[model samples]
Target: MKILVFMKQVPDTAAPISVKDNQVDASKIDKYAASPYDEYALEQALQIKDKAADTKITLVTLGPARVREMIMQGLAMGADDAVIIKHEPAKHGELVEPNDLDGLAVANVLAAAAKKIGYDLIYTGTKGVDDDQGWVGIAMGELLGLPLVAGARSTEVSGGTARVLRDVEGGKEKLEVSLPALITSSQATEPRYPTLKGIMGAKRKPVLEWDIASLGVAADALASRVERVALDMPPGRQAGRLLLGEPNDQVQELVRLLREQAKVI
Candidate 1:
């Protein structure tokens, strides 16, 4: 079996972010890591490889050259090889920023690459950390004409079918999808870290780099559908207030506050 996992590099959520001139000041950011949710997707693929020794796992990422750091991490985690869809402005015209592209555009590019590199199944994070727009995986499935299981917390493949468990309104729903399907991974097991041996081996793994044009994706398809007006930090939180008095008075005051100032009631 062959599995293709779509991963991305995103700014570390813990890092302090600042906005300048209506855009995120990239200079203020320092740390970057694999999107947390994508790690979950990679973990799922690695677990499958653990069971099926013959399975081949490949990591696919679309971004600038810096994304190689994230790719190396995935390779260290057990992906057999990797493909980097290089988004260089100088080489690929003006459409090079992966983060700037809308979900549909990004999906189109990835779907095209997926077609070039065959796969029996595809895995992706439910949403990216930076945008939190959970559209790429679903959009890819639509573009590829493949069945998709979204928010899959657990999955098992057998006899050309994949059984997926996903979260529903209050509980979980189990679904069985045929092969050549896409699954958007949610929370399942904790993602594993690369060990010393795995890290060393990752240095030698094969990495195939390709430009968007090589995938035959039209330049117009990469156009942004949405426009960003500005970026700003959220307002700071307010301090809490105390209602001091007898128990009954405090309860009454709390009710009054809820009904008046808080207005929650």
Candidate 2:
């Protein structure tokens, strides 16, 4: 089986975010890592490969040159090889920051590339950690005219069919999709760390880099429909107040505070 896994690099969630000129100050972010959810998707693909030794997993990413580091991590995690869609502003004039592209635009580029590189199944995270927009995978499925099962907790494949289990409002729902479908993975088991051997082998694995023009996608088609106007940090949390008294008195004071100051009552 040939499985394609979409991966993304994002600033570590713990990294402090600062806004400058209504945009994130990338200079302040010192660390970057794989999108957490994408790790889950990659792990799912790796698990499938584990069961079927012949399965081949390919990591696909659309981003700037720094994303190659994230691709190496994925390769270390057991993906056979990787393909990077270079997001260079000089080459692709319309391309600025790849993350700024809207879901439709990003999906169009990825879908076009996915067509160039065929796959039996596609996997990606349910949402990116940076934007938390869960639209790319779904939009890719639509653009590719393939069935998509989003937020899958687990997946089982056999005889060209994929059985997926996902969470609904109250319980899990099982879905059966034919081959050549897309699946957006949610958290299931913990993602595995790269073994020493895998890390060493990853350095020797093949990596193909492609420019936007190579995909034959028109620049206008990849133009973003959405624009980020500004970015602002969330308000700082206030310090909590402490009540010192008997249990009954504390309860009364808490209620009074809630009614008068907090005004939630």
Candidate 3:
């Protein structure tokens, strides 16, 4: 069996960020990490590889050169090989944030690469932490005309088919799908940390690099459909007010504040 996992590099959630000239100043971020959801996707692929014979897991990512490290990290986590759909900002002579490519563009790029590299199953994160955009996997499935199970919590593959369990409104729903499908993993399982041996082996793993031109994707397909007009941080928290008085007096004061200041009443 051949499996493919789509991964991405994301700034740490706690990393400090600011906006300047309508673009986020990511230089202030001290660290970058793989997307949490994608890690789960990788873990799911690795689990399947462990059980199935002759299974090879390949990691795929789309980003600038800086993201190669993130892809290597996935290799260390046990993916057999990797492919980077590379984008070079210097070549374009402009700074392009990851978000510059909308979900459609990202899906387009991944679909093109997946077509180039055939696979029986494809795995991806349910959503990206940075943008919280959960559209890529489903969109890619649509573009490829394949069955997709988005936000799958658990999956079992056997005899040319897969059974997936996913969260619903108040419970879980199970689905049975044929081979050659896409599954977007979320809360599947805890991601495994790279062992020393795995880390050392990752250095020798092959990572093929491809560009939009090589993929035969039109330039227009890579264009961002949405433009950012402005960016700003949420308002800071306000200090809490203490209502110190008799119970009745406190209630009256609280009601007054809620009615007049908060204006909820």
Residue 23 C-alpha lDDT in model 3: 66
lDDT of each: 0.89, 0.88, 0.87
TM-score of 3: 0.91
- lDDT (10s digit) by residue, model 3, range 21-65: 666666576777889999999998888887885889999998878
- Once fitted onto the true fold, the runs of candidate 3 whose alpha carbons sit more than 4 angstroms away are 89-96, 255-265
TM-scores for every candidate against the unseen true structure: 0.91, 0.90, 0.91
* lDDT digits (tens) for residues 188-215 of candidate 2: 6899999999999998999999987899
76, model 2: CA deviation in Å?
1.3
Q: Where is model 3 poorest over a 10-residue stretch in terms of lDDT?
A: 89-98
Identify the superior model by TM-score, candidate 1 or candidate 3: 1
206, model 2: CA deviation in Å? Answer: 0.7
106: Cα error in model 3, Å:
1.4
Rank candidates by lDDT, best first.
1, 2, 3
How much is 205 displaced in model 1, in angstroms?
A: 0.9
Ranking by TM-score: 1, 3, 2
Q: Which candidate tops TM-score?
A: 1
